[model samples]
Target: MPESVSAVLGPRYRAVAVPVDGGDLHVGVWEPEDAAATGAATPTAVLTHGITASHVSWAALARALPGVRLVAPDLRGRGRSRDLPAPYGMPRHADDVAAALDHLGVRDAVAVGHSMGAFVALVLADRHPHLVRSLHLVDGGMPLLPPPGVAPQDVAAAVLGPAADRLRMTFPSRTAYREFWSDHPALGPYRDEVVTAYVDYDLVGEEPELSPATRPAALEEDIRDLVDGASVQASLQGVPARPVTWYVAPRGLMDEVPPLYPDAARERWTRELPTLRLVAVDDVNHYTVVLGAHGVRQLLPHLEADLR
Candidate 1:
C-alpha cells in the first residue's frame, strides 16, 4: 500500500495513486481552505522535492501558499512510492510527474522544485511542455557537472555528504533519527516544527529498528545518472525559455561556505542560459533554502505570479 498524505499533512490534503509505466505514483494534494469558493479551477502549483525527500517535504511551502493548490509526489523509490520498480532516472521521474498532474485534472501548473527535484521538473517541462506554466528552481535544475575524472560515488559524497550516508544507517527509534538530524549542520540550525515534521515523516517501520523511506539503490542510480546521464544533460540543455527563476543558497548541505554552485559557475550559467533568473539567498544552506522561512518568502513571489 502507498503512504497516505493525510497521515502526514493532516485533513486538508488528499492522496491519489497516479498510474504510470512502472507502477502507481503517489501524489499528495493540498487544497486551500477556500477551495469550495474557488470551485474546481483553483490555481495549482506542482511541488517536487529533493532526491531523498518525499511529498511531505512541501508541507511548509503549502502552508505558505494558502490559496493555491499544491500537488507533490513521492517520486519513484521514495516515501509511499518506494516500492516502485527500477529504471529510475530523471526521465522516468518526469513521466511520473506528468502522470500525477493528469491524475489530479491539472492541465498546467507552476513547477516548483528543490535539488534533484529541480532536475526532474526541468525534464517534465522539457518533455511535456504543455503541462508547465512557469518554472521555479530552488538550488537545482541547472547543470551540475562533476569535475573531470571524478567518480559518481565521489560526486554523490561531495554533493550530499551525511544525507547519503543516513540512508544506510538505522535508527532504534524516531527520536534517534530526530537527534541525528538535529546534529546535522544543514538541518540543525533551522530546527522548527515544520522541519521536525519533515524529519519524522522520513522514518518507516517500528521502534528498536527504523529505516529511512528513501531506497539506497534508487538513490545511487539517481546520483550516478544525475552526474553523467545523457537524458539529464539534454534536459538542462533544452530547458524552455518560459519564465524561469532559480534560487541558490550561500551554504552547502554541511553549512559549508562557497556552496554547491560557486560564483564562477553561477556566472557561467547566467552567461550560458540567459533565460534563467538566479537569486542568491544568504544565511540559509541548501536544506534551509527549501524548508526555512526566509527561503519560502523568496520563493512565494515567483510561485504566486506564475499561479496567477
Candidate 2:
C-alpha cells in the first residue's frame, strides 16, 4: 500500500505529482482560496531545500512571504519523490527544477534556493537560462571547490563537515527517527508544528529495518562529486547575465570557522559576473540561514530590495 501524503501536509497544500526525467516528482504548492489576495498569480517562487532537509524547512518562509506562490520539491530520493533514479548531481537537480517549471507552465521564474537548493538555483541560471528571470541563492554560495594544500583525510572533514556517522546512521523506527530529529542541533530551533508533518512524510520504515529516503551511495557520491568538482564547478564556468543575488550566513557547521572557499568563490564570481550580487547576513550559522525564522528574515529584505 502506498503511503498517504495527505496525512502529512494537512489540507492547505495540494500535492502534485510531476513526472520528469526518469521518475515522478512530488511538489507541494500553496494556493490560497483567493489568488489575488495572497499574490499567487503575480508572485511565484519555486523553492529548493538543503541537503538532509525537505520542503518542510521552507514552509514557514514560503508561508510568511505575501504575494508569492510556493513550490517545494522533495528532491530526488527524498520525501515523496524518493523513487527518482540515482546519479544525482547539480545538473540533474537543475533538471528537476526545469521539469517543475515546464509542468507549472512558468515561462520565466524568480527562483529561490536554500543550500543545495541554492546550488540548484545557480545551475538553473547556467543550464536553463530562459526558464529563470531572477535568482536568490540562500546559504549555498559558489560551488565549494577543493582547496589547495589540504590532505585527503582532512579534506573530507573540512569540506563535508564532521564525518557523517553513515555506517551508524540508519534507524529502525519512526519514533526513534523523530527523536533523532528532536535532538538534532540543526533542526532544533524550528517550531515543532512546522516539522511534525515533515517528519511524517519523510521518514520510512521496513519492519525490523527503517531509514530515510537518503541513500548512503548518493551521500557518498555527492561528497565525492563536491571533492571532484570537475562537473558542477565547470558547469558554473559562466553564469547568466541576469539578476543574481547570493546570501551567505555569518556562521558555519561548527564554532571553529566557516568554509572560506565558498565565500571566496562567491566574491570572486561577483567580480566576474556583472549582474551577480552578494549579501552576507550576520548572527546566523550556515544551517540556520534556511532552517529557522531568523534565517528567513535575513533573506527577505535582500530579496525584496533586489527582486521587487
Give the root-mean-square deviation of each candidate in angstroms: 2.5, 3.7
Lowest summed-lDDT stretch of 10 residues in model 2?
A: 1-10
Best by lDDT: 1
Would you list the C-alpha lDDT of every candidate in the order shown?
Answer: 0.83, 0.66
lDDT of 1 by residue, 1-308 (tens): 22333454766788888888878898889888899999877998898999999888887787788888899999999998988988898988989999899888899799989999988888898899899988888888876656457665577667775677889988998779889998988887788877888888887777788899999888988886556677767876665468888888898878888687878768877888888888887778888887888888877776787788
lDDT score for candidate 1 against the true structure: 0.83
What TM value does model 2 have? 0.82
Measured by TM-score, the strongest candidate is 1
User: Can you write out model 2's per-residue Cα lDDT over 1-308, one digit (the tens) per residue?
Assistant: 12333443444577788888787888878654457664534566788876656777676676566555667887886666777878787777788878987897777677888766777777777898887778888767365545677764455456555425522366777777678766655555553555655565556667447666655555555554444445557645645566778787766654235533356666676776656677877667766676566777878886666445
